[model samples]
Target: MSTCPTCSKPATADFAPFCSERCRHIDLNRWFTGAYAVPAVELDDVDFEEAESATTPPKSDDFNA
Candidate 1:
């Protein structure tokens, strides 16, 4: 019922979203070659400081104890 994402043909049972092995491979090649990218949100300065503090070790006045 659904169309193949690569060729726009009717999708097959084996490949589901893709029409055939070739089409599937084409889509895979795009991912392997960095053709597709995942989007990320930019972190603010406040968020960066909070993350840094979480990983930093605590200081103690009595280091010898």
Candidate 2:
């Protein structure tokens, strides 16, 4: 028998790929809540911090340049 992807239990006929309805629901919840997110690969040339800073308004520097 194949193991369940979520809980590592022997898959049941009722659940087929999943061991139980609970495991199925857990997997579904993960998808719904974005818990099972795929990692995004950032390019070496991409400056994420700079991009964010540009979008935000600059704070007043009254003391010095």
Candidate 3:
């Protein structure tokens, strides 16, 4: 018998490749909720922080003005 990708249990005929409906649903939920995420690395610490700060824009200074 083949193993279930989600729970690693033995696959069942009823669930086909998956061990059970629960495992299948869990896998689906993971995809839907973005639980299966890929990690991204900061190529350069200084440039990455600068890019993040620039994209956030600056707070208004109207009160002082």
Best by TM-score: 1
| Tens digits of lDDT, candidate 1, 1-65 | 99999999999999989999999999999999999999978889999999899998877855757
On a 0 to 100 scale, what is the lDDT of residue 46 in model 3? 89
Q: Put the candidates in lDDT order, highest first.
A: 1, 2, 3
lDDT of 2 by residue, 1-65 (tens): 89999989999999989999999999999999999898997845458777776797766884467
- The alpha-carbon deviation from the true structure for residue 20 of candidate 3, after best TM-score superposition, in angstroms, is 0.7
RMSD of each: 4.9, 9.8, 8.1
Q: What TM-score would you give candidate 2 relative to the actual structure?
A: 0.54
* Residue ranges of candidate 3 with Cα displaced over 4 Å: 37-65
Error in Å for residue 23 of model 1: 0.5
Error of 1 at 53 (Å): 6.9
lDDT pick, better of 1 and 2: 1
TM-score of each: 0.68, 0.54, 0.51
